[model samples]
Target: MKKFIHEDFLLETDYAKELYHDYAKGQPIIDYHSHLPPNELAEDKNFENITQIWIEGDHYKWRAMRALGVPEKFITGKATDAEKFQKWAQTVPYTMRNPLYHWTHLELSRYFGIDELLTPESAEDIYAQCNSHLKKPSFSTRNLVSKMNVEVVCTTDDPLDNLSHHITLAESDCPVKVLPTFRPDGLINIEKVDFTDYISTLSKITGITITDLASLGEAAKKRVAYFHENGCRLSDHGLIHAYGYDYTEAEINKILSNRFAEKSISEKEIRQYKSAVLHLLGQLYAEKNWVMQLHLGPIRDTNKAILTKIGINAGVDSIGDYPQAEQLANFLNRLNNSGSLPKTILYNSNPSDNELFATMAGNFTGEEIKGKVQFGAAWWFLDQKDGIKDQLDAVSNMGLLSCSVGMLTDSRSFLSFPRHEYYRRVLCNILGNDLKDGLLPHDMKWIGKIVQDITYNNAKEFFQFPSLVENLSLKR
Candidate 1:
């Protein structure tokens, strides 16, 4: 049988074989952004069932389920694992031309060591086999990380987390680095239900009263300090648009005052409160030298009933028509003027925002690798072939591909690591084709080296990997 993955090298034509061969050699992965849990890595947790690992928490499958008209019961509810597997297999072939098709097959090939495509006929057997593997002690989360060749993975987390898990992972002798990304978008989603609990939690975490803006700020500062102590060097924000309403600090303090009074705020006032909170967070990030990433412009929760039933991420998100440049101007202008901006990487879902977001990113000279500004690779629903190509082109044509980190999994699935290899192959295919023709120089060695650097080496260098510098393999 043919190997699903090849080690021979040079996935390009013979003319460019030597170059691609040299370029595709083994390099450590820098997965700087992901939704994976830190505690799972710390615990080296293993899944009990195939469904538990694949269907339990993954929103990708949830989206497909909604698309296929499968009820939520079979997805995240009472349906048996076997029943869910059956539904998924029925939908698999129809996922044609979707990235999920490739990812599912790739995972099957790589992890389960099964080359055959998953269909109704094969689902049960494949599920049984993979379930068996999932139960093995060697198949724990940390083991999965090692097998995926992940050197560093940053998981999205709250400022209030104890980070005990992150500390545990660091203390373990594991070579893979599991870090945290501070996601404080919760502070922006201030409704009565969320705000009350958030404040209570913040108070408990920081040992301070979160009654007013000052107290809230103080509590958040304590959380950020704890994160830093545990090796968190990054923060992330998800927004509908980069719009942050303008207001005087005193006027903003009034909302904090209102929240303290337990009074309901108008929708417009909520925007002001969020904007003020954003500026505060931005200042904190810069003060601490943390990387900040923004995922902007998802018209989220379009399916109103589904949203009401299931809460957010119910596969109802679509592209928003919000003003791109205009929406971003106010907030970015604040950061730019105050010079309180951390290293910023912006990801926008709307294709029209491509140029605007890229140019806006260019203005910051910011974060991670620093000019201090950078644009992110395609993300979420936009993490597709065409979207990725557009992002690479836009960044390369507008910014510098040399500074661009290439791709991040942004996944909840351990099996999704091949998405990295997929991105790398696509990059090589593009670059190789360019060099094969006359668009790029025919100096295979330099071109290949650059490709390798972009695929993995650059990511390793750009993100905070204070631990890896001690590794002897880093010298070469």
Candidate 2:
């Protein structure tokens, strides 16, 4: 048999086959950033059907459905599960060369052990077979996480969340460390769709009348404290740019006060106002030793009419054409130079910012830095093979390979855990090919150890989740 001919995972020789095959097999996954439901992790549900698990919240599938000329009744409306699955199956063949194409077949091959390509012809059998397995008890959320060797899964949570669910899940014996991150884009925005509603909710939660900018900041800090009490070690923000235009507290407070009085603020002034809040938040994060994640460069709520009906993040956000590097670099350096910078992990949506973020991650290291700075993996729109490979190459070429954490799915689909397997295989193949070409002295054991480290160890180490790895070693 030809080596790598029939193999789906990129192993190509006897030594290569033996070494990578066993190694690339599911090891513990450390998902650093994801949108998984905290309540579901707390409950750990078994799926009722493949369509329920895969189709329910998959915006990618929804996009494909939209492209396939599938009606909204079937795409995002009140269609039956069976109808939605049929629509998705019909659209699958048209997704050729798209990352979804590889990801779908890969899930089939990896999770279900089915080699047949999915198309309109084989859709029924494939769906039925997947649904059959979904009925089994082992297909539950907790079990599936355990199956994929996920040790730690950190989910995004709003600052206003009570996080009682996260505490309950963490206290359970499920062994997956499901942590919450503080995301406060709504709190920082004066232009958010439900800004008034959000402020009311925040006021109710913190018992502080947010009559002005100072009170607003105080209320947000009070809520952030509650999040920290529940073991939140990280905070996240999403923005079109890192607020670079500098301003004094008085100037920003004037902007906020005007905003509160329903006076229109200029786009330039709005950015400065947001920047002042971000700077203060950075100070707070540093004071508490919390990691800060900035997810930047996406133009949110693009389709105005669709946004009016469907709402934000319901598949309306698109990549912005803005240059992301300079402002982001300035934001970090502004904090760093002032000695108030927290350990930061930046996720950039613009593909052009890859090299810029690469150098940014390497900028602050060693004992001088209060804590480490990091480049987060390819995220959201860039969670595909080509995009991931680009990020890996940029980070490897510029920074220490050992410092780069492997991958995270950043997906809403329950079946997306197979993505860890996909990333690992690509990672191992890249390193393996490099060894074959005499790039790093042809040391298989050392290289294999590094490959394993990137896939599993690096993430845990980077996230400071060493207890789980100690437990995994005990299991071994």
Tens-digit lDDT string for candidate 2 (1-476)? 43222464555444455446767564678887788998887887877777888888788887777877888788778888877888888888899868788788877775677778788788889888998887787777877777777778888999878787787776678768777788987887877667778888999988999876688778878877777666667888988778766788788778867777778889888788777778878877877778888888888777797678666666777777777767777777788888888888878798888888888778866475322777778877887777877888888888867666678878777678878776766666676666667676666677767777777776655555435433321100
* Residue-level lDDT tens digits of model 1 in 140-189: 88888788787888899987677778777776787688888899866767
TM values, all candidates: 0.91, 0.90
Clashing pairs in 1: 343-367, 365-371, 365-372, 365-373, 366-372, 366-373
Residue pairs clashing in model 2 are: none
Best TM-score goes to which candidate? Answer: 1
- RMSD in Å for candidate 1, one decimal? 3.9
